[model samples]
Target: MNFTLHQLQVFLKVSETKSITKAAEELFLTQPAVSIQLKNFQDQFDIPLTEVVGRQLYVTDFGQEIAFAAQAIIDQVNAINYKLAAYKGQLSGRLKIASVSTGKYVIPFFLSGFLRGNPQIELKLDVTNKAQVVRSLVDNEIDFALVSILPDKVPVHAVPLMENRLVLVAGRDFQPPLGVSGIEIFQYITLIYRESGSGTRLAMEGFLNDHKVPIKKMLVLTSNEAVKQAVMAGLGCSIMPVIGIKNELKQGDLKVIEVKGLPICTYWNLIYLKSKRLSPVAEAFLSYLDREKNTVIEQNFQ
Candidate 1:
Protein backbone atom coordinates (compact mmCIF):
# COMPACT_ATOMS: atom_id res chain seq x y z
CA MET A 1 0.00 0.00 0.00
CA ASN A 2 1.17 3.60 -0.68
CA PHE A 3 0.67 6.70 1.44
CA THR A 4 1.65 10.28 0.65
CA LEU A 5 3.73 12.62 2.83
CA HIS A 6 0.69 14.88 3.32
CA GLN A 7 -1.25 11.93 4.71
CA LEU A 8 1.58 11.07 7.07
CA GLN A 9 1.66 14.69 8.27
CA VAL A 10 -2.06 14.72 8.95
CA PHE A 11 -1.89 11.42 10.82
CA LEU A 12 1.04 12.64 12.90
CA LYS A 13 -0.79 15.81 13.90
CA VAL A 14 -3.92 13.80 14.70
CA SER A 15 -1.86 11.49 16.91
CA GLU A 16 -0.22 14.39 18.72
CA THR A 17 -3.44 16.29 19.49
CA LYS A 18 -5.71 13.22 19.76
CA SER A 19 -8.45 15.33 18.19
CA ILE A 20 -9.11 15.90 14.52
CA THR A 21 -10.58 19.35 15.26
CA LYS A 22 -7.51 20.51 17.13
CA ALA A 23 -5.14 19.02 14.55
CA ALA A 24 -7.04 20.83 11.81
CA GLU A 25 -6.82 24.14 13.67
CA GLU A 26 -3.06 23.80 14.11
CA LEU A 27 -2.56 22.74 10.50
CA PHE A 28 -4.86 25.47 9.12
CA LEU A 29 -7.22 22.93 7.55
CA THR A 30 -10.92 22.25 7.85
CA GLN A 31 -12.05 19.46 10.21
CA PRO A 32 -13.76 17.48 7.46
CA ALA A 33 -10.67 17.79 5.29
CA VAL A 34 -8.37 16.53 8.04
CA SER A 35 -10.73 13.69 8.94
CA ILE A 36 -10.90 12.55 5.31
CA GLN A 37 -7.11 12.59 5.00
CA LEU A 38 -6.72 10.64 8.26
CA LYS A 39 -9.18 8.04 7.04
CA ASN A 40 -7.29 7.66 3.79
CA PHE A 41 -3.97 7.34 5.64
CA GLN A 42 -5.42 4.66 7.96
CA ASP A 43 -6.80 2.66 5.04
CA GLN A 44 -3.28 1.86 3.82
CA PHE A 45 -2.30 0.20 7.10
CA ASP A 46 -3.78 -3.13 8.18
CA ILE A 47 -3.26 -2.27 11.86
CA PRO A 48 -5.28 0.51 13.41
CA LEU A 49 -3.20 3.58 14.08
CA THR A 50 -5.84 5.27 16.22
CA GLU A 51 -9.09 4.37 17.93
CA VAL A 52 -12.03 6.16 19.53
CA VAL A 53 -13.59 5.35 22.86
CA GLY A 54 -15.98 7.14 25.20
CA ARG A 55 -16.35 9.90 22.59
CA GLN A 56 -12.68 10.76 22.73
CA LEU A 57 -9.89 9.97 20.28
CA TYR A 58 -6.74 8.20 21.39
CA VAL A 59 -3.56 7.18 19.65
CA THR A 60 -3.05 3.46 20.12
CA ASP A 61 0.33 2.16 21.28
CA PHE A 62 1.21 1.34 17.68
CA GLY A 63 0.05 4.78 16.60
CA GLN A 64 2.54 6.37 19.01
CA GLU A 65 5.37 4.46 17.36
CA ILE A 66 4.25 5.59 13.92
CA ALA A 67 4.01 9.19 15.16
CA PHE A 68 7.63 9.04 16.33
CA ALA A 69 8.74 7.77 12.93
CA ALA A 70 6.65 10.44 11.26
CA GLN A 71 8.32 13.14 13.31
CA ALA A 72 11.78 11.93 12.21
CA ILE A 73 10.71 11.89 8.54
CA ILE A 74 9.30 15.41 8.78
CA ASP A 75 12.47 16.66 10.44
CA GLN A 76 14.64 15.11 7.73
CA VAL A 77 12.51 16.62 5.00
CA ASN A 78 12.80 20.05 6.61
CA ALA A 79 16.56 19.59 6.86
CA ILE A 80 16.73 18.78 3.12
CA ASN A 81 14.80 21.95 2.32
CA TYR A 82 17.09 23.99 4.56
CA LYS A 83 20.18 22.49 2.90
CA LEU A 84 18.82 23.33 -0.53
CA ALA A 85 18.24 26.92 0.57
CA ALA A 86 21.81 27.08 1.91
CA TYR A 87 23.18 26.03 -1.48
CA LYS A 88 21.41 29.14 -2.87
CA GLY A 89 23.31 31.25 -0.27
CA GLN A 90 20.37 31.57 2.10
CA LEU A 91 20.89 30.35 5.68
CA SER A 92 17.84 28.40 6.84
CA GLY A 93 17.30 25.81 9.56
CA ARG A 94 15.51 25.20 12.83
CA LEU A 95 17.28 26.47 15.95
CA LYS A 96 15.90 25.02 19.18
CA ILE A 97 16.73 26.62 22.52
CA ALA A 98 15.50 25.82 26.02
CA SER A 99 15.73 28.54 28.64
CA VAL A 100 14.78 28.94 32.26
CA SER A 101 11.58 30.86 32.85
CA THR A 102 13.25 34.07 34.02
CA GLY A 103 15.51 33.98 30.97
CA LYS A 104 12.63 35.33 28.90
CA TYR A 105 13.95 38.85 29.45
CA VAL A 106 17.46 37.95 28.25
CA ILE A 107 17.20 35.40 25.44
CA PRO A 108 14.76 37.31 23.21
CA PHE A 109 17.02 40.38 23.00
CA PHE A 110 19.92 38.17 21.92
CA LEU A 111 17.76 36.35 19.36
CA SER A 112 16.18 39.42 17.74
CA GLY A 113 19.13 40.41 15.56
CA PHE A 114 20.06 36.87 14.51
CA LEU A 115 16.49 35.98 13.63
CA ARG A 116 16.09 39.15 11.57
CA GLY A 117 19.31 38.48 9.65
CA ASN A 118 18.27 34.91 8.81
CA PRO A 119 14.65 35.30 7.72
CA GLN A 120 14.31 31.63 6.78
CA ILE A 121 15.30 30.19 10.17
CA GLU A 122 12.65 28.44 12.24
CA LEU A 123 13.12 29.09 15.94
CA LYS A 124 11.78 26.77 18.66
CA LEU A 125 12.14 28.32 22.09
CA ASP A 126 11.04 26.48 25.23
CA VAL A 127 10.88 28.62 28.35
CA THR A 128 10.84 26.36 31.39
CA ASN A 129 12.39 26.00 34.82
CA LYS A 130 16.12 25.37 35.21
CA ALA A 131 15.71 21.65 35.86
CA GLN A 132 13.69 21.03 32.69
CA VAL A 133 15.98 23.27 30.63
CA VAL A 134 19.02 21.32 31.80
CA ARG A 135 17.24 18.04 31.14
CA SER A 136 16.44 19.11 27.57
CA LEU A 137 20.06 20.12 26.99
CA VAL A 138 21.47 16.86 28.46
CA ASP A 139 19.04 14.80 26.40
CA ASN A 140 20.13 16.59 23.20
CA GLU A 141 16.58 17.87 22.67
CA ILE A 142 17.80 21.43 22.07
CA ASP A 143 20.83 23.17 20.59
CA PHE A 144 21.32 25.53 23.52
CA ALA A 145 20.16 26.36 27.05
CA LEU A 146 20.04 29.84 28.59
CA VAL A 147 20.75 29.94 32.30
CA SER A 148 22.01 32.26 35.04
CA ILE A 149 23.28 29.53 37.29
CA LEU A 150 25.69 27.07 35.67
CA PRO A 151 24.76 23.40 35.88
CA ASP A 152 27.80 22.06 37.68
CA LYS A 153 26.82 18.51 36.85
CA VAL A 154 27.09 19.00 33.09
CA PRO A 155 30.32 19.42 31.15
CA VAL A 156 29.49 22.38 28.91
CA HIS A 157 30.86 25.55 27.37
CA ALA A 158 29.29 28.82 28.52
CA VAL A 159 29.11 32.21 26.82
CA PRO A 160 28.43 34.94 29.30
CA LEU A 161 25.95 37.34 27.77
CA MET A 162 25.15 39.93 30.44
CA GLU A 163 24.84 40.57 34.14
CA ASN A 164 21.72 39.28 35.91
CA ARG A 165 20.93 41.05 39.15
CA LEU A 166 18.38 39.73 41.64
CA VAL A 167 16.96 42.09 44.21
CA LEU A 168 14.70 41.67 47.21
CA VAL A 169 11.54 43.64 46.62
CA ALA A 170 8.29 44.42 48.40
CA GLY A 171 5.01 45.98 47.34
CA ARG A 172 4.70 49.77 47.12
CA ASP A 173 3.31 49.99 50.62
CA PHE A 174 6.04 48.18 52.52
CA GLN A 175 7.98 50.19 55.16
CA PRO A 176 11.08 49.15 57.00
CA PRO A 177 11.29 49.45 60.77
CA LEU A 178 13.40 52.10 62.64
CA GLY A 179 16.66 50.12 62.75
CA VAL A 180 16.94 46.79 61.00
CA SER A 181 20.04 45.76 59.11
CA GLY A 182 21.33 42.92 56.95
CA ILE A 183 19.76 39.48 57.54
CA GLU A 184 17.74 40.76 60.45
CA ILE A 185 15.33 42.42 58.01
CA PHE A 186 14.05 38.98 56.94
CA GLN A 187 12.47 38.58 60.36
CA TYR A 188 10.05 41.45 59.61
CA ILE A 189 8.38 40.04 56.48
CA THR A 190 7.36 36.77 54.85
CA LEU A 191 9.37 35.53 51.86
CA ILE A 192 7.93 34.37 48.55
CA TYR A 193 9.95 31.69 46.82
CA ARG A 194 9.97 29.75 43.57
CA GLU A 195 9.55 25.96 43.53
CA SER A 196 12.43 23.57 44.11
CA GLY A 197 14.92 23.15 41.20
CA SER A 198 14.32 26.66 39.89
CA GLY A 199 17.53 28.64 39.38
CA THR A 200 16.02 31.57 41.25
CA ARG A 201 15.15 29.30 44.13
CA LEU A 202 18.65 27.87 44.17
CA ALA A 203 20.24 31.30 44.23
CA MET A 204 17.86 32.59 46.91
CA GLU A 205 18.57 29.57 49.06
CA GLY A 206 22.32 29.95 48.60
CA PHE A 207 22.12 33.57 49.69
CA LEU A 208 19.97 32.71 52.71
CA ASN A 209 22.30 29.97 53.82
CA ASP A 210 25.41 32.05 53.34
CA HIS A 211 24.00 34.87 55.45
CA LYS A 212 22.35 32.50 57.95
CA VAL A 213 19.08 34.36 57.54
CA PRO A 214 16.09 33.06 59.43
CA ILE A 215 12.85 33.11 57.43
CA LYS A 216 9.70 33.65 59.45
CA LYS A 217 7.21 32.71 56.77
CA MET A 218 7.53 31.29 53.23
CA LEU A 219 5.25 30.72 50.22
CA VAL A 220 6.21 28.63 47.21
CA LEU A 221 5.04 29.48 43.70
CA THR A 222 5.71 27.61 40.45
CA SER A 223 6.53 30.46 38.07
CA ASN A 224 8.22 33.87 38.06
CA GLU A 225 5.05 35.69 36.99
CA ALA A 226 3.05 34.04 39.76
CA VAL A 227 5.62 34.96 42.35
CA LYS A 228 5.72 38.53 41.05
CA GLN A 229 1.93 38.76 41.22
CA ALA A 230 1.87 37.30 44.70
CA VAL A 231 4.42 39.86 45.86
CA MET A 232 2.53 42.68 44.13
CA ALA A 233 -0.59 41.58 45.93
CA GLY A 234 1.37 42.12 49.16
CA LEU A 235 1.46 38.45 50.04
CA GLY A 236 5.20 38.70 50.70
CA CYS A 237 8.48 40.07 49.43
CA SER A 238 10.58 37.99 47.02
CA ILE A 239 14.05 38.09 45.57
CA MET A 240 13.63 38.33 41.79
CA PRO A 241 15.68 39.24 38.77
CA VAL A 242 15.71 43.00 38.18
CA ILE A 243 15.08 42.47 34.49
CA GLY A 244 11.84 40.64 35.21
CA ILE A 245 10.58 43.41 37.47
CA LYS A 246 11.56 46.44 35.42
CA ASN A 247 8.00 47.49 34.59
CA GLU A 248 6.78 46.93 38.13
CA LEU A 249 9.62 48.97 39.54
CA LYS A 250 9.11 51.75 36.99
CA GLN A 251 5.38 51.94 37.68
CA GLY A 252 5.95 52.18 41.47
CA ASP A 253 4.09 48.90 41.97
CA LEU A 254 7.19 47.38 43.53
CA LYS A 255 10.17 48.80 45.43
CA VAL A 256 13.59 47.34 45.97
CA ILE A 257 14.46 46.85 49.66
CA GLU A 258 17.97 47.92 50.52
CA VAL A 259 19.90 45.64 52.83
CA LYS A 260 23.63 44.98 53.19
CA GLY A 261 24.98 42.51 50.60
CA LEU A 262 21.74 42.61 48.58
CA PRO A 263 21.24 42.47 44.81
CA ILE A 264 22.84 39.09 44.14
CA CYS A 265 24.63 39.27 40.82
CA THR A 266 25.16 36.48 38.30
CA TYR A 267 25.98 36.19 34.61
CA TRP A 268 23.38 34.93 32.15
CA ASN A 269 25.12 32.22 30.19
CA LEU A 270 24.32 30.53 26.87
CA ILE A 271 25.53 26.98 27.33
CA TYR A 272 25.87 23.80 25.26
CA LEU A 273 27.40 20.48 26.04
CA LYS A 274 31.08 20.08 25.11
CA SER A 275 30.42 16.79 23.31
CA LYS A 276 27.53 17.94 21.08
CA ARG A 277 28.42 18.88 17.51
CA LEU A 278 27.32 22.32 16.40
CA SER A 279 25.08 22.69 13.36
CA PRO A 280 25.89 25.31 10.70
CA VAL A 281 23.00 27.39 11.97
CA ALA A 282 24.30 27.12 15.53
CA GLU A 283 27.81 28.11 14.40
CA ALA A 284 26.40 31.12 12.60
CA PHE A 285 24.55 32.16 15.74
CA LEU A 286 27.77 31.93 17.77
CA SER A 287 29.56 34.18 15.31
CA TYR A 288 26.67 36.61 15.37
CA LEU A 289 26.71 36.69 19.16
CA ASP A 290 30.44 37.35 19.17
CA ARG A 291 29.94 40.29 16.83
CA GLU A 292 26.69 41.73 18.21
CA LYS A 293 26.11 40.74 21.86
CA ASN A 294 27.70 43.86 23.27
CA THR A 295 25.74 46.19 21.02
CA VAL A 296 22.46 44.38 21.60
CA ILE A 297 22.89 44.42 25.37
CA GLU A 298 23.84 48.09 25.44
CA GLN A 299 20.96 49.08 23.22
CA ASN A 300 18.16 47.10 24.84
CA PHE A 301 19.21 46.29 28.40
CA GLN A 302 21.01 49.47 29.41
Candidate 2:
Protein backbone atom coordinates (compact mmCIF):
# COMPACT_ATOMS: atom_id res chain seq x y z
CA MET A 1 0.00 0.00 0.00
CA ASN A 2 1.44 3.33 -1.12
CA PHE A 3 0.13 5.84 1.39
CA THR A 4 1.40 9.39 1.71
CA LEU A 5 2.40 11.05 4.99
CA HIS A 6 -0.83 13.07 4.78
CA GLN A 7 -2.85 9.87 4.71
CA LEU A 8 -0.96 8.54 7.73
CA GLN A 9 -1.60 11.80 9.57
CA VAL A 10 -5.29 11.64 8.69
CA PHE A 11 -5.49 8.08 9.94
CA LEU A 12 -3.75 8.88 13.20
CA LYS A 13 -5.90 11.92 13.86
CA VAL A 14 -9.11 10.03 13.14
CA SER A 15 -7.94 7.26 15.46
CA GLU A 16 -7.06 9.69 18.21
CA THR A 17 -10.37 11.55 18.04
CA LYS A 18 -12.55 8.56 17.22
CA SER A 19 -14.59 10.80 14.97
CA ILE A 20 -14.06 11.60 11.33
CA THR A 21 -15.96 14.85 11.77
CA LYS A 22 -13.64 16.05 14.52
CA ALA A 23 -10.59 14.79 12.64
CA ALA A 24 -11.66 16.77 9.61
CA GLU A 25 -12.14 19.90 11.67
CA GLU A 26 -8.72 19.49 13.26
CA LEU A 27 -7.10 18.88 9.87
CA PHE A 28 -8.91 21.89 8.41
CA LEU A 29 -10.57 19.74 5.81
CA THR A 30 -14.17 18.93 5.05
CA GLN A 31 -15.77 15.78 6.41
CA PRO A 32 -16.25 14.27 2.95
CA ALA A 33 -12.62 14.84 2.01
CA VAL A 34 -11.43 13.12 5.17
CA SER A 35 -13.78 10.22 4.62
CA ILE A 36 -12.64 9.79 1.01
CA GLN A 37 -8.99 9.76 1.97
CA LEU A 38 -9.61 7.34 4.83
CA LYS A 39 -11.55 5.06 2.52
CA ASN A 40 -8.72 5.02 0.00
CA PHE A 41 -6.21 4.28 2.74
CA GLN A 42 -8.35 1.48 4.09
CA ASP A 43 -9.04 -0.01 0.64
CA GLN A 44 -5.33 -0.72 0.13
CA PHE A 45 -5.21 -2.98 3.18
CA ASP A 46 -6.87 -6.34 3.68
CA ILE A 47 -8.04 -5.66 7.24
CA PRO A 48 -10.73 -3.14 8.10
CA LEU A 49 -9.25 -0.13 9.79
CA THR A 50 -12.29 0.87 11.79
CA GLU A 51 -15.84 -0.09 12.59
CA VAL A 52 -18.90 1.71 13.88
CA VAL A 53 -20.64 0.34 16.91
CA GLY A 54 -23.79 1.91 18.35
CA ARG A 55 -23.20 5.02 16.21
CA GLN A 56 -19.69 5.46 17.58
CA LEU A 57 -16.48 4.93 15.61
CA TYR A 58 -13.76 2.68 16.97
CA VAL A 59 -10.45 1.56 15.56
CA THR A 60 -9.96 -2.12 15.11
CA ASP A 61 -7.03 -4.05 16.67
CA PHE A 62 -5.07 -3.84 13.43
CA GLY A 63 -5.86 -0.16 13.28
CA GLN A 64 -4.36 0.23 16.75
CA GLU A 65 -1.07 -1.21 15.54
CA ILE A 66 -1.18 0.98 12.46
CA ALA A 67 -1.88 4.02 14.60
CA PHE A 68 1.15 3.29 16.78
CA ALA A 69 3.37 2.94 13.73
CA ALA A 70 1.90 6.08 12.24
CA GLN A 71 2.52 7.94 15.49
CA ALA A 72 6.15 6.82 15.51
CA ILE A 73 6.56 8.27 12.03
CA ILE A 74 4.82 11.48 13.04
CA ASP A 75 6.94 11.74 16.19
CA GLN A 76 10.14 11.31 14.22
CA VAL A 77 9.04 13.96 11.75
CA ASN A 78 8.21 16.32 14.63
CA ALA A 79 11.57 15.55 16.22
CA ILE A 80 13.34 16.45 12.98
CA ASN A 81 11.33 19.67 12.77
CA TYR A 82 12.21 20.44 16.38
CA LYS A 83 15.92 19.81 15.81
CA LEU A 84 16.00 22.00 12.70
CA ALA A 85 14.12 24.80 14.46
CA ALA A 86 16.44 24.59 17.46
CA TYR A 87 19.40 24.80 15.10
CA LYS A 88 17.87 28.10 13.99
CA GLY A 89 17.32 29.07 17.66
CA GLN A 90 13.51 28.97 17.58
CA LEU A 91 10.69 26.76 18.80
CA SER A 92 8.41 25.27 16.14
CA GLY A 93 5.96 22.32 16.19
CA ARG A 94 2.31 21.61 16.78
CA LEU A 95 0.81 21.40 20.25
CA LYS A 96 -2.48 19.64 20.99
CA ILE A 97 -4.20 20.49 24.25
CA ALA A 98 -7.57 19.63 25.71
CA SER A 99 -9.29 21.35 28.59
CA VAL A 100 -12.48 20.92 30.57
CA SER A 101 -15.40 23.21 29.72
CA THR A 102 -14.68 25.60 32.61
CA GLY A 103 -11.03 26.05 31.68
CA LYS A 104 -12.21 27.31 28.30
CA TYR A 105 -12.81 30.69 29.92
CA VAL A 106 -9.13 31.36 30.66
CA ILE A 107 -6.93 28.95 28.66
CA PRO A 108 -7.20 31.06 25.52
CA PHE A 109 -5.28 33.90 27.10
CA PHE A 110 -2.53 31.49 28.04
CA LEU A 111 -2.41 30.32 24.41
CA SER A 112 -2.62 33.81 22.96
CA GLY A 113 0.50 34.99 24.75
CA PHE A 114 2.35 31.82 23.91
CA LEU A 115 1.35 32.09 20.27
CA ARG A 116 2.55 35.70 20.06
CA GLY A 117 5.85 34.67 21.63
CA ASN A 118 6.26 31.62 19.41
CA PRO A 119 4.64 32.49 16.16
CA GLN A 120 5.85 29.39 14.41
CA ILE A 121 4.33 26.96 16.87
CA GLU A 122 0.84 25.72 15.95
CA LEU A 123 -1.88 24.91 18.44
CA LYS A 124 -5.00 22.74 18.40
CA LEU A 125 -7.23 23.29 21.36
CA ASP A 126 -10.23 21.16 22.33
CA VAL A 127 -12.55 22.39 25.06
CA THR A 128 -14.54 19.37 26.16
CA ASN A 129 -15.92 17.58 29.19
CA LYS A 130 -13.84 16.00 31.96
CA ALA A 131 -14.52 12.52 30.56
CA GLN A 132 -13.23 13.34 27.10
CA VAL A 133 -10.22 15.13 28.59
CA VAL A 134 -9.44 12.11 30.71
CA ARG A 135 -9.74 9.82 27.68
CA SER A 136 -7.40 12.12 25.81
CA LEU A 137 -4.88 11.80 28.63
CA VAL A 138 -5.17 8.03 28.66
CA ASP A 139 -4.85 7.74 24.89
CA ASN A 140 -1.99 10.26 24.69
CA GLU A 141 -4.16 12.30 22.32
CA ILE A 142 -2.99 15.66 23.69
CA ASP A 143 0.13 17.25 25.06
CA PHE A 144 -1.64 18.85 27.99
CA ALA A 145 -5.05 18.74 29.62
CA LEU A 146 -6.40 21.51 31.84
CA VAL A 147 -8.83 20.05 34.36
CA SER A 148 -9.72 20.23 38.04
CA ILE A 149 -10.65 16.61 38.60
CA LEU A 150 -8.11 14.10 37.33
CA PRO A 151 -9.16 10.50 36.93
CA ASP A 152 -7.69 8.38 39.72
CA LYS A 153 -6.89 5.45 37.46
CA VAL A 154 -4.95 7.53 34.95
CA PRO A 155 -1.26 7.72 35.83
CA VAL A 156 -0.65 11.38 35.19
CA HIS A 157 1.54 14.15 36.55
CA ALA A 158 -0.73 17.03 37.50
CA VAL A 159 0.64 20.51 38.15
CA PRO A 160 -1.47 23.18 39.77
CA LEU A 161 -2.05 26.12 37.45
CA MET A 162 -4.85 28.24 38.92
CA GLU A 163 -7.66 28.31 41.43
CA ASN A 164 -11.04 26.84 40.41
CA ARG A 165 -14.06 27.36 42.64
CA LEU A 166 -17.58 26.12 41.96
CA VAL A 167 -20.06 28.57 43.43
CA LEU A 168 -23.83 28.69 43.82
CA VAL A 169 -25.10 31.56 41.73
CA ALA A 170 -28.60 32.80 40.91
CA GLY A 171 -30.23 35.39 38.75
CA ARG A 172 -31.84 38.49 40.26
CA ASP A 173 -35.31 36.99 40.37
CA PHE A 174 -34.30 33.87 42.26
CA GLN A 175 -33.35 34.79 45.80
CA PRO A 176 -31.30 32.14 47.59
CA PRO A 177 -30.99 32.04 51.34
CA LEU A 178 -27.32 32.24 52.22
CA GLY A 179 -25.69 31.38 55.57
CA VAL A 180 -27.34 27.96 55.41
CA SER A 181 -25.92 24.46 55.50
CA GLY A 182 -24.89 22.84 52.23
CA ILE A 183 -27.76 20.40 52.66
CA GLU A 184 -30.29 23.15 53.22
CA ILE A 185 -29.13 25.14 50.21
CA PHE A 186 -30.33 22.47 47.77
CA GLN A 187 -33.66 22.11 49.49
CA TYR A 188 -34.37 25.80 49.11
CA ILE A 189 -33.63 26.16 45.39
CA THR A 190 -33.78 24.18 42.19
CA LEU A 191 -30.17 23.31 41.37
CA ILE A 192 -29.01 23.57 37.79
CA TYR A 193 -25.96 21.46 36.96
CA ARG A 194 -23.58 20.71 34.13
CA GLU A 195 -23.64 17.29 32.50
CA SER A 196 -22.66 14.24 34.53
CA GLY A 197 -19.18 13.96 32.97
CA SER A 198 -18.36 17.55 33.77
CA GLY A 199 -15.89 18.43 36.51
CA THR A 200 -18.30 20.93 37.98
CA ARG A 201 -20.99 18.25 38.34
CA LEU A 202 -18.49 15.79 39.81
CA ALA A 203 -17.29 18.33 42.35
CA MET A 204 -20.87 19.19 43.27
CA GLU A 205 -21.66 15.52 43.70
CA GLY A 206 -18.67 15.04 45.99
CA PHE A 207 -19.79 17.98 48.10
CA LEU A 208 -23.35 16.60 48.23
CA ASN A 209 -22.16 13.15 49.22
CA ASP A 210 -20.01 14.65 51.95
CA HIS A 211 -22.92 16.68 53.28
CA LYS A 212 -25.32 13.72 52.89
CA VAL A 213 -27.60 15.76 50.67
CA PRO A 214 -30.09 13.60 48.87
CA ILE A 215 -30.04 13.44 45.09
CA LYS A 216 -32.98 15.61 44.26
CA LYS A 217 -34.44 17.66 41.44
CA MET A 218 -31.91 19.16 39.03
CA LEU A 219 -31.88 20.88 35.64
CA VAL A 220 -28.90 19.38 33.80
CA LEU A 221 -27.32 21.24 30.94
CA THR A 222 -24.64 20.01 28.58
CA SER A 223 -22.32 23.02 28.72
CA ASN A 224 -21.13 25.74 31.09
CA GLU A 225 -22.48 28.35 28.68
CA ALA A 226 -25.86 26.67 28.76
CA VAL A 227 -25.91 26.58 32.54
CA LYS A 228 -24.94 30.24 32.66
CA GLN A 229 -27.74 31.14 30.28
CA ALA A 230 -30.20 29.05 32.26
CA VAL A 231 -29.20 30.81 35.46
CA MET A 232 -29.53 34.22 33.78
CA ALA A 233 -33.00 33.30 32.54
CA GLY A 234 -33.96 32.45 36.12
CA LEU A 235 -34.69 28.84 35.21
CA GLY A 236 -32.71 27.75 38.25
CA CYS A 237 -29.59 28.38 40.29
CA SER A 238 -26.35 26.62 39.38
CA ILE A 239 -22.92 25.74 40.71
CA MET A 240 -20.29 26.91 38.27
CA PRO A 241 -16.74 28.15 38.13
CA VAL A 242 -16.12 31.74 39.14
CA ILE A 243 -14.07 32.15 35.99
CA GLY A 244 -17.14 31.40 33.88
CA ILE A 245 -19.41 33.87 35.64
CA LYS A 246 -17.21 36.97 35.87
CA ASN A 247 -19.16 38.90 33.25
CA GLU A 248 -22.50 37.80 34.68
CA LEU A 249 -21.43 38.96 38.12
CA LYS A 250 -20.08 42.29 36.88
CA GLN A 251 -23.09 42.92 34.66
CA GLY A 252 -25.38 42.13 37.61
CA ASP A 253 -26.99 39.25 35.79
CA LEU A 254 -26.10 36.91 38.61
CA LYS A 255 -25.23 37.04 42.30
CA VAL A 256 -23.26 34.68 44.47
CA ILE A 257 -25.35 32.79 47.01
CA GLU A 258 -23.10 31.50 49.72
CA VAL A 259 -23.59 28.17 51.48
CA LYS A 260 -21.54 26.68 54.31
CA GLY A 261 -18.47 24.90 52.90
CA LEU A 262 -19.64 26.10 49.51
CA PRO A 263 -17.91 27.17 46.36
CA ILE A 264 -16.00 23.90 46.36
CA CYS A 265 -12.47 25.08 45.92
CA THR A 266 -10.11 23.11 43.70
CA TYR A 267 -6.93 23.76 41.81
CA TRP A 268 -6.81 23.71 38.02
CA ASN A 269 -4.35 20.99 37.17
CA LEU A 270 -2.27 20.89 34.00
CA ILE A 271 -1.86 17.22 33.44
CA TYR A 272 -0.46 14.71 30.95
CA LEU A 273 0.06 10.99 31.10
CA LYS A 274 3.12 10.14 33.15
CA SER A 275 4.41 7.77 30.48
CA LYS A 276 3.77 10.07 27.53
CA ARG A 277 6.81 11.49 25.81
CA LEU A 278 6.60 15.19 25.07
CA SER A 279 8.04 16.79 21.95
CA PRO A 280 10.30 19.81 22.15
CA VAL A 281 7.40 22.13 21.42
CA ALA A 282 5.26 20.43 24.03
CA GLU A 283 8.11 20.64 26.52
CA ALA A 284 8.65 24.29 25.72
CA PHE A 285 4.93 25.01 26.12
CA LEU A 286 4.92 23.18 29.46
CA SER A 287 7.85 25.25 30.66
CA TYR A 288 6.15 28.37 29.44
CA LEU A 289 2.93 27.50 31.26
CA ASP A 290 4.80 26.55 34.41
CA ARG A 291 6.56 29.91 34.40
CA GLU A 292 3.64 32.10 33.27
CA LYS A 293 0.33 30.41 34.09
CA ASN A 294 -0.07 31.92 37.54
CA THR A 295 0.71 35.43 36.37
CA VAL A 296 -1.56 35.05 33.38
CA ILE A 297 -4.39 33.70 35.50
CA GLU A 298 -4.01 36.50 38.01
CA GLN A 299 -4.15 39.15 35.31
CA ASN A 300 -6.83 37.65 33.07
CA PHE A 301 -9.13 35.98 35.57
CA GLN A 302 -9.09 38.63 38.29
Q: Pick the candidate with the highest TM-score.
A: 1
RMSD of each: 3.2, 4.2
Q: For candidate 2, what is the TM-score?
A: 0.74
* lDDT at 251, model 1: 99
Instruction: Report, for every candidate in turn, its global Cα lDDT versus the true structure.
Output: 0.93, 0.87
**lDDT value, candidate 2, whole model:** 0.87
Full-model lDDT, candidate 1: 0.93
Local lDDT at 277 for model 1: 98
RMSD of 2: 4.2
Q: Which parts of model 1 have CA positions greater than 4 angstroms off?
A: 1-58, 177-181
lDDT per residue as tens, model 1, 90-187: 99999999999999988999999999999889898989999999999999999999999999879999999999999999999888777875678899
**What local lDDT does model 1 show for residue 48?**
92
TM-score of each: 0.87, 0.74
Which pairs of residues clash in candidate 1, taking residues 3 or more apart in a chain or in different chains? none
